[model samples]
Target: MVRQDIPLPDGPVRTCIGCRRRAAKRELLRVTVGPDRDGRQTVVPDPASSAPGRGAHLHPTRECYDLAVRRKAFTRALRLTGGPSSAPVGDYLDSRHDDDRPHLATD
Candidate 1:
Protein backbone atom coordinates (compact mmCIF):
# COMPACT_ATOMS: atom_id res chain seq x y z
CA MET A 1 0.00 0.00 0.00
CA VAL A 2 1.14 3.56 -0.70
CA ARG A 3 1.88 5.89 2.22
CA GLN A 4 -0.78 8.31 1.07
CA ASP A 5 -3.50 5.71 1.48
CA ILE A 6 -2.67 5.03 5.12
CA PRO A 7 -5.05 6.59 7.59
CA LEU A 8 -3.71 9.22 9.94
CA PRO A 9 -4.19 9.23 13.68
CA ASP A 10 -7.78 8.76 14.75
CA GLY A 11 -8.70 12.23 15.87
CA PRO A 12 -9.30 15.71 14.66
CA VAL A 13 -6.33 16.86 12.57
CA ARG A 14 -5.74 20.13 10.72
CA THR A 15 -3.14 21.37 8.30
CA CYS A 16 -1.11 24.35 9.34
CA ILE A 17 -1.58 27.06 6.75
CA GLY A 18 1.87 28.40 7.60
CA CYS A 19 4.08 25.30 7.44
CA ARG A 20 1.48 23.15 5.70
CA ARG A 21 2.04 20.37 8.22
CA ARG A 22 -0.80 18.27 9.58
CA ALA A 23 -1.16 18.10 13.33
CA ALA A 24 -3.76 17.52 15.95
CA LYS A 25 -6.38 20.24 16.08
CA ARG A 26 -5.48 21.03 19.68
CA GLU A 27 -1.82 21.66 18.80
CA LEU A 28 -2.44 24.23 16.12
CA LEU A 29 -4.00 27.67 16.35
CA ARG A 30 -7.19 28.48 14.53
CA VAL A 31 -7.50 31.66 12.49
CA THR A 32 -10.55 33.23 10.92
CA VAL A 33 -10.94 35.83 8.24
CA GLY A 34 -12.07 39.07 9.80
CA PRO A 35 -12.26 42.72 8.77
CA ASP A 36 -9.65 45.32 9.55
CA ARG A 37 -10.31 48.96 10.57
CA ASP A 38 -11.16 49.91 6.99
CA GLY A 39 -13.48 46.88 6.66
CA ARG A 40 -10.98 44.90 4.63
CA GLN A 41 -10.65 41.21 5.39
CA THR A 42 -7.74 40.17 7.61
CA VAL A 43 -6.62 37.03 9.34
CA VAL A 44 -7.38 36.94 13.05
CA PRO A 45 -6.32 34.38 15.64
CA ASP A 46 -9.14 32.29 17.00
CA PRO A 47 -7.62 30.59 20.04
CA ALA A 48 -10.95 29.40 21.29
CA SER A 49 -11.97 28.32 17.79
CA SER A 50 -15.30 30.04 18.37
CA ALA A 51 -15.32 32.33 15.37
CA PRO A 52 -18.19 31.46 13.05
CA GLY A 53 -17.00 30.77 9.52
CA ARG A 54 -14.30 29.01 7.58
CA GLY A 55 -11.26 28.84 9.85
CA ALA A 56 -7.68 28.03 8.92
CA HIS A 57 -5.23 26.36 11.25
CA LEU A 58 -1.68 27.53 11.92
CA HIS A 59 1.28 26.87 14.15
CA PRO A 60 1.60 29.40 16.97
CA THR A 61 5.31 29.95 16.32
CA ARG A 62 6.35 33.12 14.54
CA GLU A 63 8.33 31.16 11.96
CA CYS A 64 5.19 29.40 10.74
CA TYR A 65 3.29 32.67 10.67
CA ASP A 66 6.02 34.25 8.57
CA LEU A 67 5.99 31.34 6.14
CA ALA A 68 2.24 31.67 5.65
CA VAL A 69 2.40 35.42 5.08
CA ARG A 70 5.43 35.20 2.80
CA ARG A 71 3.89 32.44 0.73
CA LYS A 72 0.48 34.14 0.61
CA ALA A 73 -0.96 30.96 2.03
CA PHE A 74 -3.47 32.86 4.12
CA THR A 75 -5.01 34.55 1.14
CA ARG A 76 -5.21 31.34 -0.83
CA ALA A 77 -6.44 29.22 2.05
CA LEU A 78 -9.05 31.69 3.26
CA ARG A 79 -10.03 32.83 -0.23
CA LEU A 80 -9.50 36.42 0.83
CA THR A 81 -9.96 39.23 -1.63
CA GLY A 82 -6.76 41.21 -2.10
CA GLY A 83 -3.87 40.66 0.25
CA PRO A 84 -5.33 40.35 3.72
CA SER A 85 -3.57 41.99 6.61
CA SER A 86 -1.51 39.64 8.76
CA ALA A 87 -0.78 42.08 11.54
CA PRO A 88 -3.34 40.56 13.86
CA VAL A 89 -1.86 37.08 13.61
CA GLY A 90 1.65 38.44 13.82
CA ASP A 91 0.90 40.45 16.93
CA TYR A 92 -0.75 37.49 18.59
CA LEU A 93 2.27 35.27 17.96
CA ASP A 94 4.63 37.95 19.19
CA SER A 95 2.74 38.51 22.40
CA ARG A 96 2.26 34.83 23.04
CA HIS A 97 6.02 34.21 23.28
CA ASP A 98 7.35 37.26 25.03
CA ASP A 99 10.20 37.34 27.57
CA ASP A 100 7.80 36.33 30.31
CA ARG A 101 7.87 32.75 29.05
CA PRO A 102 8.52 30.43 31.94
CA HIS A 103 11.85 28.68 31.91
CA LEU A 104 12.15 25.05 32.82
CA ALA A 105 13.93 24.32 36.07
CA THR A 106 16.88 22.03 35.59
CA ASP A 107 17.67 19.57 38.34
Candidate 2:
Protein backbone atom coordinates (compact mmCIF):
# COMPACT_ATOMS: atom_id res chain seq x y z
CA MET A 1 0.00 0.00 0.00
CA VAL A 2 1.15 3.52 -0.79
CA ARG A 3 0.96 6.33 1.73
CA GLN A 4 0.80 10.07 1.15
CA ASP A 5 3.80 12.07 2.39
CA ILE A 6 1.88 15.16 3.43
CA PRO A 7 -1.62 15.79 4.69
CA LEU A 8 -3.92 18.47 3.42
CA PRO A 9 -4.97 21.48 5.47
CA ASP A 10 -7.84 20.83 7.86
CA GLY A 11 -10.13 23.50 6.42
CA PRO A 12 -10.65 25.29 3.12
CA VAL A 13 -8.71 28.53 2.55
CA ARG A 14 -9.90 31.43 0.41
CA THR A 15 -8.47 34.84 -0.51
CA CYS A 16 -10.19 38.01 0.53
CA ILE A 17 -11.19 40.21 -2.39
CA GLY A 18 -10.41 43.33 -0.35
CA CYS A 19 -7.37 42.70 1.84
CA ARG A 20 -6.07 39.98 -0.50
CA ARG A 21 -5.34 37.71 2.44
CA ARG A 22 -5.85 33.97 2.58
CA ALA A 23 -7.94 32.67 5.44
CA ALA A 24 -10.22 29.83 6.37
CA LYS A 25 -13.38 29.80 4.26
CA ARG A 26 -15.58 30.01 7.33
CA GLU A 27 -13.80 33.15 8.50
CA LEU A 28 -14.72 35.12 5.41
CA LEU A 29 -17.92 36.39 3.89
CA ARG A 30 -19.01 35.32 0.41
CA VAL A 31 -20.47 37.60 -2.22
CA THR A 32 -22.06 36.74 -5.53
CA VAL A 33 -23.26 38.59 -8.58
CA GLY A 34 -26.88 38.23 -9.60
CA PRO A 35 -29.22 39.94 -12.00
CA ASP A 36 -31.67 42.54 -10.82
CA ARG A 37 -35.25 43.07 -12.05
CA ASP A 38 -33.87 45.19 -14.88
CA GLY A 39 -31.49 42.41 -15.93
CA ARG A 40 -28.48 44.41 -14.75
CA GLN A 41 -25.83 42.69 -12.73
CA THR A 42 -25.91 43.41 -9.02
CA VAL A 43 -23.66 42.40 -6.18
CA VAL A 44 -25.44 40.26 -3.60
CA PRO A 45 -24.32 39.18 -0.17
CA ASP A 46 -24.33 35.50 0.75
CA PRO A 47 -24.40 35.53 4.54
CA ALA A 48 -24.93 31.77 4.62
CA SER A 49 -22.25 31.35 1.93
CA SER A 50 -24.46 28.80 0.17
CA ALA A 51 -25.49 30.87 -2.81
CA PRO A 52 -25.67 28.86 -6.03
CA GLY A 53 -23.13 30.69 -8.21
CA ARG A 54 -19.61 32.01 -8.45
CA GLY A 55 -18.73 33.63 -5.13
CA ALA A 56 -15.90 35.87 -3.89
CA HIS A 57 -14.85 35.89 -0.27
CA LEU A 58 -14.18 39.08 1.68
CA HIS A 59 -13.59 40.26 5.21
CA PRO A 60 -16.72 41.87 6.64
CA THR A 61 -15.14 45.23 7.44
CA ARG A 62 -15.46 48.70 5.94
CA GLU A 63 -11.69 48.96 5.66
CA CYS A 64 -11.50 45.85 3.50
CA TYR A 65 -14.41 47.03 1.41
CA ASP A 66 -12.73 50.35 0.71
CA LEU A 67 -9.46 48.69 -0.14
CA ALA A 68 -11.18 46.28 -2.49
CA VAL A 69 -12.90 49.10 -4.31
CA ARG A 70 -9.77 51.23 -4.52
CA ARG A 71 -7.84 48.29 -5.89
CA LYS A 72 -10.56 47.31 -8.33
CA ALA A 73 -10.37 43.75 -7.08
CA PHE A 74 -14.09 43.17 -7.48
CA THR A 75 -13.92 43.48 -11.26
CA ARG A 76 -11.32 40.78 -11.47
CA ALA A 77 -12.64 38.60 -8.66
CA LEU A 78 -16.21 38.72 -9.91
CA ARG A 79 -15.09 38.38 -13.56
CA LEU A 80 -17.00 41.41 -14.70
CA THR A 81 -16.00 43.37 -17.78
CA GLY A 82 -16.71 46.67 -16.02
CA GLY A 83 -16.14 47.61 -12.41
CA PRO A 84 -19.39 47.23 -10.60
CA SER A 85 -20.47 49.84 -8.07
CA SER A 86 -19.87 48.94 -4.43
CA ALA A 87 -23.13 50.47 -3.23
CA PRO A 88 -24.90 47.18 -2.72
CA VAL A 89 -22.05 45.84 -0.64
CA GLY A 90 -21.68 49.10 1.26
CA ASP A 91 -25.36 49.11 2.07
CA TYR A 92 -25.25 45.56 3.23
CA LEU A 93 -22.28 46.24 5.43
CA ASP A 94 -23.99 49.27 6.89
CA SER A 95 -26.92 47.13 7.97
CA ARG A 96 -24.54 44.99 10.01
CA HIS A 97 -23.42 45.97 13.50
CA ASP A 98 -20.28 45.40 15.56
CA ASP A 99 -22.12 42.72 17.50
CA ASP A 100 -22.69 40.83 14.24
CA ARG A 101 -18.99 40.82 13.36
CA PRO A 102 -17.66 37.89 15.32
CA HIS A 103 -15.36 36.49 12.65
CA LEU A 104 -13.99 39.78 11.32
CA ALA A 105 -11.13 40.31 13.71
CA THR A 106 -7.79 40.62 11.92
CA ASP A 107 -4.54 39.22 13.18
Candidate 3:
Protein backbone atom coordinates (compact mmCIF):
# COMPACT_ATOMS: atom_id res chain seq x y z
CA MET A 1 0.00 0.00 0.00
CA VAL A 2 2.56 2.55 -1.09
CA ARG A 3 1.37 6.00 -2.07
CA GLN A 4 3.12 7.55 -5.06
CA ASP A 5 1.99 11.07 -4.31
CA ILE A 6 4.78 11.77 -1.85
CA PRO A 7 7.13 14.10 -3.65
CA LEU A 8 10.78 13.28 -3.86
CA PRO A 9 12.45 14.19 -0.62
CA ASP A 10 15.26 16.69 -0.33
CA GLY A 11 18.49 15.76 1.38
CA PRO A 12 18.87 15.55 5.16
CA VAL A 13 16.72 17.91 7.18
CA ARG A 14 18.26 20.16 9.87
CA THR A 15 16.86 22.83 12.16
CA CYS A 16 18.36 26.29 12.31
CA ILE A 17 19.66 26.76 15.83
CA GLY A 18 18.86 30.44 15.31
CA CYS A 19 15.44 30.62 13.67
CA ARG A 20 14.56 27.12 14.81
CA ARG A 21 13.23 26.33 11.34
CA ARG A 22 13.63 23.02 9.58
CA ALA A 23 15.32 23.04 6.19
CA ALA A 24 17.23 20.69 3.97
CA LYS A 25 20.83 20.15 5.02
CA ARG A 26 22.00 21.76 1.79
CA GLU A 27 19.95 24.83 2.58
CA LEU A 28 21.57 25.37 5.97
CA LEU A 29 25.07 25.93 7.26
CA ARG A 30 26.71 23.67 9.82
CA VAL A 31 28.65 24.88 12.86
CA THR A 32 30.36 23.01 15.64
CA VAL A 33 32.19 23.71 18.88
CA GLY A 34 35.84 23.10 18.27
CA PRO A 35 39.07 23.96 19.99
CA ASP A 36 40.84 27.05 18.74
CA ARG A 37 44.57 27.58 18.67
CA ASP A 38 44.45 28.76 22.25
CA GLY A 39 42.75 25.48 23.23
CA ARG A 40 39.44 27.10 23.94
CA GLN A 41 36.16 25.67 22.64
CA THR A 42 34.62 27.94 20.05
CA VAL A 43 31.73 27.74 17.66
CA VAL A 44 33.09 27.41 14.15
CA PRO A 45 31.47 27.17 10.74
CA ASP A 46 31.89 23.93 8.84
CA PRO A 47 31.24 25.10 5.31
CA ALA A 48 32.11 21.67 3.93
CA SER A 49 30.00 19.93 6.62
CA SER A 50 32.75 17.43 7.25
CA ALA A 51 33.85 18.46 10.73
CA PRO A 52 33.77 15.81 13.42
CA GLY A 53 31.89 15.97 16.73
CA ARG A 54 28.31 17.24 17.10
CA GLY A 55 27.23 20.11 14.88
CA ALA A 56 24.51 22.77 14.90
CA HIS A 57 22.78 24.15 11.84
CA LEU A 58 21.73 27.70 11.04
CA HIS A 59 20.68 29.95 8.20
CA PRO A 60 23.54 31.97 6.72
CA THR A 61 21.86 35.30 7.38
CA ARG A 62 22.58 37.93 10.00
CA GLU A 63 18.97 37.88 11.17
CA CYS A 64 19.01 34.24 12.16
CA TYR A 65 22.53 34.41 13.50
CA ASP A 66 21.65 37.38 15.66
CA LEU A 67 18.46 35.74 16.88
CA ALA A 68 20.40 32.69 17.95
CA VAL A 69 22.83 34.84 19.89
CA ARG A 70 20.04 36.78 21.52
CA ARG A 71 18.44 33.57 22.72
CA LYS A 72 21.67 31.83 23.75
CA ALA A 73 20.72 29.00 21.44
CA PHE A 74 24.30 28.05 20.68
CA THR A 75 25.19 27.24 24.26
CA ARG A 76 22.20 24.98 24.61
CA ALA A 77 22.58 23.36 21.20
CA LEU A 78 26.30 22.76 21.58
CA ARG A 79 26.29 22.06 25.32
CA LEU A 80 28.84 24.79 25.76
CA THR A 81 29.76 26.49 29.00
CA GLY A 82 31.37 29.83 29.80
CA GLY A 83 29.98 31.28 26.58
CA PRO A 84 32.29 29.93 23.95
CA SER A 85 32.96 32.49 21.25
CA SER A 86 30.82 32.33 18.08
CA ALA A 87 32.71 35.05 16.23
CA PRO A 88 34.00 32.50 13.75
CA VAL A 89 30.52 31.62 12.55
CA GLY A 90 29.61 35.28 12.42
CA ASP A 91 32.70 36.09 10.39
CA TYR A 92 31.99 33.24 7.98
CA LEU A 93 28.48 34.49 7.38
CA ASP A 94 29.75 38.02 6.89
CA SER A 95 32.22 36.91 4.24
CA ARG A 96 29.40 35.30 2.26
CA HIS A 97 27.29 37.62 0.13
CA ASP A 98 24.20 35.43 0.11
CA ASP A 99 22.07 36.57 2.99
CA ASP A 100 19.48 33.85 2.26
CA ARG A 101 16.54 36.01 3.14
CA PRO A 102 13.26 34.14 3.47
CA HIS A 103 11.54 36.00 0.62
CA LEU A 104 12.63 38.72 -1.83
CA ALA A 105 13.34 36.10 -4.44
CA THR A 106 15.88 37.10 -7.07
CA ASP A 107 15.42 34.24 -9.45
Candidate 4:
Protein backbone atom coordinates (compact mmCIF):
# COMPACT_ATOMS: atom_id res chain seq x y z
CA MET A 1 0.00 0.00 0.00
CA VAL A 2 1.30 3.46 -0.91
CA ARG A 3 0.27 6.67 0.81
CA GLN A 4 -0.47 9.62 -1.42
CA ASP A 5 -0.45 13.31 -0.44
CA ILE A 6 -3.93 14.79 -0.15
CA PRO A 7 -4.75 18.51 -0.12
CA LEU A 8 -6.61 19.71 2.92
CA PRO A 9 -9.51 22.10 2.94
CA ASP A 10 -8.52 25.75 2.82
CA GLY A 11 -9.70 27.89 5.69
CA PRO A 12 -11.35 31.27 5.25
CA VAL A 13 -9.13 34.33 5.04
CA ARG A 14 -9.95 37.66 6.67
CA THR A 15 -8.34 41.04 6.21
CA CYS A 16 -6.57 42.52 9.19
CA ILE A 17 -7.95 45.92 10.10
CA GLY A 18 -4.51 47.06 11.21
CA CYS A 19 -2.26 45.81 8.42
CA ARG A 20 -5.09 45.84 5.89
CA ARG A 21 -3.86 42.51 4.52
CA ARG A 22 -5.62 39.25 3.94
CA ALA A 23 -4.47 36.36 6.15
CA ALA A 24 -5.74 33.04 7.37
CA LYS A 25 -8.21 33.16 10.24
CA ARG A 26 -5.82 31.17 12.42
CA GLU A 27 -3.12 33.74 11.82
CA LEU A 28 -5.17 36.59 13.20
CA LEU A 29 -7.16 37.49 16.29
CA ARG A 30 -10.91 38.03 16.28
CA VAL A 31 -12.58 40.81 18.24
CA THR A 32 -16.31 41.10 18.65
CA VAL A 33 -18.38 44.13 19.53
CA GLY A 34 -21.45 43.86 21.71
CA PRO A 35 -23.76 46.07 23.66
CA ASP A 36 -24.14 45.98 27.41
CA ARG A 37 -27.41 46.24 29.29
CA ASP A 38 -26.98 49.99 29.26
CA GLY A 39 -26.24 49.96 25.52
CA ARG A 40 -22.56 50.66 26.07
CA GLN A 41 -20.14 49.33 23.49
CA THR A 42 -18.07 46.37 24.56
CA VAL A 43 -15.20 44.69 22.81
CA VAL A 44 -14.66 41.02 23.47
CA PRO A 45 -11.82 38.79 22.38
CA ASP A 46 -13.09 35.90 20.33
CA PRO A 47 -10.15 33.56 20.02
CA ALA A 48 -12.30 30.77 18.62
CA SER A 49 -13.20 33.04 15.68
CA SER A 50 -16.86 32.38 16.28
CA ALA A 51 -18.93 34.93 18.12
CA PRO A 52 -22.54 36.01 17.88
CA GLY A 53 -21.88 39.61 16.88
CA ARG A 54 -19.94 41.87 14.57
CA GLY A 55 -16.24 41.08 14.50
CA ALA A 56 -12.97 42.70 13.52
CA HIS A 57 -9.83 40.78 12.82
CA LEU A 58 -6.35 41.99 13.69
CA HIS A 59 -2.79 40.75 13.83
CA PRO A 60 -1.57 39.77 17.26
CA THR A 61 1.06 42.45 17.72
CA ARG A 62 1.39 45.64 19.70
CA GLU A 63 2.27 47.66 16.62
CA CYS A 64 -0.73 46.34 14.72
CA TYR A 65 -3.01 46.93 17.68
CA ASP A 66 -1.77 50.47 18.05
CA LEU A 67 -2.26 51.15 14.38
CA ALA A 68 -5.78 49.75 14.49
CA VAL A 69 -6.63 51.85 17.51
CA ARG A 70 -5.25 54.99 15.91
CA ARG A 71 -7.17 54.37 12.69
CA LYS A 72 -10.34 53.31 14.51
CA ALA A 73 -10.40 50.25 12.33
CA PHE A 74 -12.21 48.13 14.87
CA THR A 75 -15.09 50.55 15.07
CA ARG A 76 -15.32 50.76 11.32
CA ALA A 77 -15.09 47.04 10.82
CA LEU A 78 -17.67 46.25 13.48
CA ARG A 79 -19.78 49.30 12.74
CA LEU A 80 -19.57 50.16 16.39
CA THR A 81 -20.95 53.32 17.91
CA GLY A 82 -17.94 53.63 20.23
CA GLY A 83 -14.27 52.63 20.31
CA PRO A 84 -12.68 49.63 21.90
CA SER A 85 -10.59 49.86 25.03
CA SER A 86 -6.96 50.24 24.08
CA ALA A 87 -5.78 49.68 27.63
CA PRO A 88 -7.00 46.09 27.75
CA VAL A 89 -5.57 45.31 24.34
CA GLY A 90 -2.28 46.95 25.25
CA ASP A 91 -2.19 45.12 28.56
CA TYR A 92 -2.84 41.80 26.88
CA LEU A 93 0.00 42.39 24.41
CA ASP A 94 2.21 43.65 27.17
CA SER A 95 1.67 40.43 29.08
CA ARG A 96 2.56 38.43 26.03
CA HIS A 97 5.68 40.54 25.59
CA ASP A 98 6.62 39.92 29.18
CA ASP A 99 6.20 36.19 28.72
CA ASP A 100 8.55 36.31 25.73
CA ARG A 101 11.22 38.15 27.72
CA PRO A 102 14.05 36.39 29.50
CA HIS A 103 13.75 36.35 33.25
CA LEU A 104 16.63 37.71 35.37
CA ALA A 105 17.99 35.80 38.31
CA THR A 106 17.88 37.56 41.64
CA ASP A 107 19.55 35.27 44.12
User: Top lDDT: which candidate number?
Assistant: 1
The residue pairs that clash in candidate 3, if any, are none
Candidate 4, residues 1-107: lDDT per residue as tens digits?
A: 52356332379878888988777878888888755556677665677877887788888888888899889887788886656554555676788789999999999
Per-candidate local distance difference test: 0.89, 0.81, 0.87, 0.76
Candidate 2 segments exceeding 4 Å error: 1-9, 98-107
TM-scores of the candidates are 0.83, 0.76, 0.79, 0.74
Worst 10-residue stretch by lDDT in candidate 2? 1-10
Model 1, which residues run further than 4 Å from truth?
1-7, 99-107
lDDT of 3 by residue, 1-107 (tens): 74586543478878899998777888889999888899999999998999998889999888999999999999999887779989999888987855444557698
> All candidates: CA RMSD in angstroms?
4.0, 7.5, 6.6, 6.9
Candidate 3 weakest lDDT stretch, 10 residues: 96-105
Error of 2 at 65 (Å): 0.7
Q: Is candidate 1 or candidate 2 better by lDDT?
A: 1
Report the Cα lDDT for residue 18, model 4: 91
Which candidate tops TM-score? 1
In model 4, which residue pairs have backbone atoms overlapping below 3 Å?
none
Output the lDDT of residue 106, model 1.
100
TM-score of 1: 0.83
Model 2: lDDT to the true structure: 0.81
* TM-score sort, best first: 1, 3, 2, 4
